[model samples]
Target chain A: MRIAFTSVGTNWDAQIDPRFGRTAFLVLFNEETAQLEAVDNSGVQADAHGAGTAMAQRIYELHPDVLITGNGPGDTASKALKNLHMRIYVEAHNMSLKEAYEKYKKQELTAL
Target chain B: MTNSGIFKLAIASGKGGTGKTLLSTNLADYLARKQAVLLADLDVEEPNDALFFHAENKVITPQYKMIPDWQSDRCTLCGDCTRQCKFHAVIRLGEFITVFNELCHSCYACSDLCPEQALPMKPYRMGETRHQILNGLQLIESRLDVGQEQAVPLIHATQKYICELESKPAIQILDCPPGTSCPVVAAVDGADLVLLVTEPTPFGLNDLKLAVETMRQIDKAFAVVINRQGMGDDAVENWCKSENITVAARIPYDRQLAEQYAAAKLAWCDNTALEEALEELALFIQQKQVQYA
Candidate 1:
């Protein structure tokens, strides 16, 4: 499964960005390949309004099977991503990317 | 004032409850007795001008702005509309093309540039413009529908409606939304003269400067009106004097005025102090009409 998480930086140790919409970097992890991909989200940050929807759109394009972020997506973004075949887990705030991934493996994260 | 053409006057403020509506309502009421007047409460988010008057024979017109609706079959998945939208209102991922109404500016840039004609502009109801005669004053109140985020479209629609209405040779007083933002710009952009109302407090002075700067930036001839003259320090008046901005009128601090205002009654009749201030504002408008004419 390709799991996507909002992160403050691209590295594995980088802390998770609590905000889903205006997150700094979107880090994608492929569990089988053990590979990581980071997409810069400056465009989402610069968006004057509807950053929630924009961030959701970006994640939709990535085709991630699971989304892990703090607070999950807001109402508007959640509605846009409603039909997506992905499990959204939230409350991973302040955790490093590696720690969050480890916690997800252990079924420690809660679903939104 | 020479009445060669319609004089569009706007009442604006940087802070909320600084007497923009007070000045607008009274000025429109006072002036309508002499000549034709159109009072537009352009504060669409919270329209309260109707509260001050017993308006009868209500006529409401629904206001709409165009928003792009996706036609999936016609779309080639070219991503043209998404790329062209500056507001990020439209986004396409896989087969789903989503349109966020709150983010749409209704510029038609995306819809017009779409090659496949997949995105067509559709009228989305944002607000309502109500017209009524309030003691001979032509009162037009534009109110945004609940959950509508963008107010500029409704304000523009109200302005357009006002323009299309008959009686062009009157003084049009627009009670604008507070703050120097997009909605304020849209509301005041149509006015020839703008009356920026403020108090004499520090907070009032701070916002007054911003309001004044906005007026200058827009290149609209504007003057200041000091409400609650005796309450705050003289910073506002001193600043206006130093800046060479006209002090059109200063409404003295009167508890009676406040009491009447709270009860939805015009201070024009009950409070002589407030009445005189409105008179001064009326005079200033008359003089400005000639200048603008």
Candidate 2:
């Protein structure tokens, strides 16, 4: 199964947000091999209207079975995640990305 | 020019964690002592100002309309809606048409441009607002329901409650959300003055410039307030100097202030410098409003 993780609300890479533009991290992981590949939403700066949805679309295209991020599972993000058939997991403070993935592998992260 | 109308001030920054709420709410309390004030917390998502007042929230509801499910039998898949959509939210595949609700801005273009009569429009309950009284101030705030894409519509609805005020106060401070998005724009749109609160750090300076540009573009009068001033270098001050935006005040890093805010004790009187800064800001805004009038 293919898995993906997208960061919204706050960008861990830039660490600072301009608030005007879109910023999110998109990661793709393979459940069969545990290999991970991720990409930043390059179209973030171009978001003028429907920015949140634009970021959501990029994540949806990844088509992952599992998703991990800072936003809660109950946000508007769930709608986009649901489109891709992806399970959602909320990343609390102090939990690293690798640890989050490990928890997903162990069936610790539940579907939203 | 005699302080007759409401003095709308926006507390905003382009970035989060800039202490905009602390400055807006605490300052509101300081001014409310001698004058009537209306504190509008416009930050729908994660509004933390109420954490400072812990006031009882009365519900405020707003309604919205969106595209209703269309019948496929009458639809010919002419792709009129798809081509008309700038957001690319609507797609037509053979006989099936799917609407990406998240991508749609509720523009009504799809429904209006639909050649077939199959398209139906319906109302979607987007979100609701909650009003409360803190101290002597009427604190009105709105909360966007989870999964709601449109936050500005609900914010606009919250402002309707403010018009019912018996007498327009000398000061009305709006605690804006942390961003330069539509929600932030709605908060600062009709404001006469804006108080931008930011920290003294690279991230703070980086985001402040963007927010400043936005304010300038909108032609709104604004000043700067530096929170946690001594934590980092003087980049914020230098940037302010270069940008020509006046630094109205600076609040040092104080553990006591944090404790006070956490305890819901936003009213402050013992801090002389803090009191002086807010009072000065209030006077400055009043003077600016006079010029505009």
Best by lDDT: 1
Predicted structure 2: lDDT = 0.69
Q: Model 2: per-residue lDDT, tens digit, B1-293?
A: 22456668889998898888888888888788877888888887767676667666555546453755667897888878766667746655335566666567677888877878666677666666666765667777777779877677767766766666565566788899887878888888778788888889999999998899889888888899988768989999998998788998888777777777667776357666567777777777667777777
Q: List the residue pairs that clash in candidate 1.
A: none
Chain A alone, TM-score for each of the models?
Answer: 0.96, 0.64
Q: Which stretches of candidate 1 lie over 4 Å from their true place?
A: B1-4
Model 2: per-residue Cα lDDT over A34-78, one tens digit each: 675667666655545544544454554455665565545434434
Model 1 — TM-score against the truth? 0.96
TM-scores for all candidates: the values are: 0.96, 0.69
For model 2 chain B, the run of ten residues with the poorest summed lDDT: B88-97
Give a tens-digit lDDT track for model 1, residues B1-293: 22448788889999888988888887788787888788999999999998888877899999999999999899888888888887778988678788998889998988899998888999999989999975568889999999998889999899889778866637788999999999999999868888899999999999999988888888888889999999979999999999999999999888878888888877787778887888888888878777777
Residue A52, model 2: Cα distance from true site in angstroms:
13
Candidate 2, number of clashes: 1
lDDT of 2 at A108: 76
